[model samples]
Target: MGANIGDNLFSIFNSMTEYMIDAGQRSVLYWDIMRRRGNQYLEHMAKNIPDVLKFDYELLINGRSLPEPVNYGLLKILPPKGVAIDNRKRPFVVIDPRAGHGPGIAGFKADSEIGVALSEGYPCYFIGFTPMPEPNQTIEAVIRGEAHFLAHVNELHPKADGKPVVIGNCQAGWAVMLLAATRPELCGPIIVAGAPLSYWEGVHGQNPMRYTGGMMGGSWMAALLSDLGHGNFDGAWLVQNFEGLNPANTLWKKQYNLYSRIDTEAKRYLEFECWWGDHVFLSAAEIQYIVDNLFLGNKLSGSEIVTSDNISVDLRKISSPIVCFCSKGDDITPPQQALGWILDLYQSVDDIYASNQTIVYCVHEHTGHLGIFVSSNVARKEYFEFASNIDLIDCLPPGLYEAVIEKINYDTVNPDLVTGNYISRFEKRTLDDIHSLGCNTLEDNRCFATVKRLSDVNYGLYRIMVQPMVRAMTTEENAKLMRRLHPLRLGYELLSDHNPMMKPLEWAAKWVSEHRQPVKPDNHFLQWQTLYSDLLATSLNIFRDWRDMMTEQMFFGIYSQDWLQALMGLRASDAPPRKHPGHDPVHLAFIEQRKKEILAGMDKGGPREALIRGFIYVRIPEGACDERGFEMIRRIRAEHHDNHLSEFKKTCREQFFMILLDARRAVEAIPQLLVGREEAGQKFFEIIRKVATAPGPLGKEADMRLAEIKALFIPVRPEQDEK
Candidate 1:
């Protein structure tokens, strides 16, 4: 009996071991299947990626052909239709960044910044460039070209109430701000999305990417790479750097997510990759200038940069209202980089106001750098809100504001759409609030200064010793081949059969589709798989955080320690004051004279007239005022018959619809209608302001008239001024 029991136990133990081995094999098979599924999805999506060669808009000039060459030797877009008929008060210009990417990202879809503007009846223009810039085209030339574009836009819409609104994305952000500051008269409000100005400012623990320059011995590598490219820097290198920042996403997570939900996420993956894959190149000079002046030197916001023609660029010189859109979650251009300049340039909030600058900023909680500009959800909320309330932003008092958009409900019967019910409020923000985000990190500044000195020494050595040899060794043909073989570029190019790996993927995809056992969205096994994936992603992020901390500490120890500083001849004192020649008495006099002239002009209208003009310029139409509506204004003026300000305003309120429907035509007809009431238009504004400012609500009739006037003018109240 004892022998029989022992044999039974041994048999059960063997059965258990076999079951364990089978489960382990199944898990391995599941992982393999998931990975293959992801690659297959990517392959299918790659095949459907839109070709970059199509033009979405028709271009026309009076003397040009029906289909003018889409390529302008730089870039082109399908010029948006309805621009001619749409109100030009809110002109939308989308400037795409030329940083390692081709054009059309700003209008890649129907739900982009361009699309939002088009839907709102704002005349939209896209600024794109060709694959190659003109040989002689310098940054200065581009700035001048942009100024010319805005000038042409102004001429096209002579009756527009306000100047053109320019929106710049990424690299284009600083470019547009530079143009606006240089030629402030040509533009109105300026919007910079995802642009970094104060490059050296970042949180202590968060942004280690900025340290890579110092750790890698500064921008000498960029120079070396450009030299190897034979006078042109392949933008693929910059794209590669971006990819290296997130290994898990670039290597596995991105593809795996697509594979696991290939049916649902395929379209989005392709849309993004279309823009990502279309890489462009920059002239060696252009790339060198950007790396040296903007990224490495941090000279833009510091007022240390000079244009090729010796013109100084200063952020404080820009008079137009500036709106900065940044994301806290953006690693490339964090909020600190976007907003640190405010504290760097000015000592106090009063200085900002004294400069007559209207600065507004909005921060999103968790959108990454790319999503800040390209995500559909971001476009719908942030871009849409900005587009709709741009006029309101323009009217905001000079100072800093944090724009907050709050959603509210409305009845369907309301004239405006339901989605439009959300109200946008501008809350005042203190300089301290902005400065709190590590703008006080002067230690980082010290380290970057050391980097600048080292980079200069390294670049000089490279130019003297290595650059000539590199140029001599690398021919244009070899450079082209090298570019084609670059890892980042190859990923896109390889899907073509020319790549051996692609052949198997093609066949494997077909076989899998034919014998597919796709899991449902809510399958138990799939849920477990997703849960495991999330845990893995979290683990990867934790590992990256730890690695970054170690890297940062090492960087600090090497460059920021006292021993290292002493060796480099570094001092703890702040950078020396900028040297400037004493102001020219003659130029100073001219500036004072201009200021006096402006004040005198304001005096001519008085506070009331100035206020009235401001209101009239921004007010929406009260009623259906078309071309023929001016007659009603004439009738009102005749009916009023008196020069009294109150009576003139009364007449205006009674005929609010006529003015609201068409202000341009009404303003033109005001002279004829006010033949007897010469001061009628000026008086009309004061009375409306009084009604708008009155403590209690106006009666129904009065309220209707007030609403009409409000529609015609965006109310600019003293209390609403940035505090």
Candidate 2:
């Protein structure tokens, strides 16, 4: 019995010793990861990485000194391995937000925005900036510079099929919006990913970030910070604010994640940190303008912010198709902020059509703001589908539609054509459909307007009382010191190779790696340790929720009161209704004008024209359009594509608008376009028939349209239908 007891003791002792050895190895591995991360971060920072583009780029235009001088460059991205660009394909211009971080996040990896474009044979261009703005480089100059850059891109890719597809990431989203609005004729389809145009918009209980401008007593502090920086607003402050928004992620979660999976996650962590750590700066005037006009005044959508040349930036001015991509999970630029511009500009769905505009939106169920641009999965799915079917999106009728991307299980789209892994479909949506998603009430508007007014008052007060004192004390050296002392910077510098304290870490880490012992899957202590980490993250998130709840309650409690609102020049019952000018005669004039043009050329079109007209007429009933249907239409069109198709596209687009204006009357005119070309008319009908039958049974509205097409173009013989 004593010998058995001794054996049991020895077994227990061996297990304990193995566990300790594994624990020691893990500790060494962690420090080694940190050491490597520190070295990677230092190297990245030393490189002055701009254009956040991971691929090679040649500088095309320099903003070192010019009339509209800004510290930005227009770069043409060199295609990576296994990818060759076709200039004939639509060119892609990706504009990364210079909010606080440097550019390149959009193109930093092989599976990113630039990557996606390059993979699909599109000539890619990146508009990014140096770390600092040129002397006296205002936002106005920046916008002008960007406009020039795009004009240059258009000039370079003169052979491209359409205008360049401009993608705006975050702050760059608004900049692109300005470009599109100001120079609508220069752009193709616009993709705004996580771009927040309407800054004062948010769900009251959910997105508490909007209340920040109000809670901080307005943008006066921003002005002060800018002045203290000696004319430049450190983008580091912007990065700091982003980090503060998620304490759980910043304080515990991100580091813990790296620590837990240091073996595998080290590279990814270092790569992301390279982007996150290096920040860009905006001129004082630029940041103040952003804060006052956009965040505080909430003026972009209302056409209140004017260009340097006194041109108003009205979204309605843009003629290009716009694709808004947002995420339910993005707290920084929520769906409301990204999409609310539509509400502020157009009062109803018809307004969108009357304005002769097309807006397509796709809301992801769970991607964060950064993920919209950076995540490979998002690139593979959303961006890939978008790049593939851009022409179809461009060809969509003028109105609002929701792009639904679904995973496909079918091996083939047709007998010979293989299906892509995913498919994209646009479903017609109404103004109410968007409203159901969320738009703040007039009362909410009043509160935001009050915040705007208070900002102006506070700005004036700061100008009088604080500006003189700040300007007197501000110096370039102090500004640099403050920037270097920022928490983000301190973390990097402290952990880097330059720090003597981290010297022994390299030697120790190398020794540990050689004698590495890893914890087994069944280790009880390791399992408990993981559980503890989860608890910490959950607890921090819970605290964040509680804190957000309190901030929201305080915001409403203070702003929703009647007497206080009246004191701020708002009436107790002052809730102005947002108007829709769609039904107004002036707005309706465009449709009338289009209808007249269609009627004028009603009898002057060939097989292509007839096909487009008949196809459009058949789709006048909303549910007739499907992704598979569009794809089939595209393939058929490709078989018959010519320079004439461009004119035909315009023709189809005009006719489609006519159908939307008055479907009953538009259908009557279908006979005018198709009656002369009987053989082509029959062919067009067959094409429509194929598309209609593509997605199994025809939808109800589609069935009606199909019957109408058959009535318009009945074949000379029954066998023609078999063809």
Q: Pick the candidate with the highest TM-score.
A: 2
- The best candidate in terms of lDDT: 2
Expressed as tens digits, the lDDT of each residue in 605-684 for candidate 2 is 65666667776765656442456776677677678666333455577677776566566765666666665576566666
Clashes of each: 15, 4
User: Which regions of candidate 2 fall more than 4 Å away from where they truly are?
Assistant: 1-19, 48-52, 411-419, 575-592, 622-624, 641-645, 715-723
* Residue-by-residue lDDT tens digits, candidate 1, 596-701: 5543333232323333333333332221111112222323335656224333342333233233334444433433433444444446655555423322233465
- TM for candidate 1 is 0.74
Assess each prediction's global lDDT (C-alpha) against the native.
0.65, 0.80
- Among residues 3 or more apart in sequence or in different chains, the pairs in candidate 2 whose N, CA or C atoms overlap within 3 Å are 51-104, 52-103, 52-104, 53-104
Give me the displacement of residue 273 in model 2, in angstroms: 0.9
Error of 1 at 527 (Å): 3.4
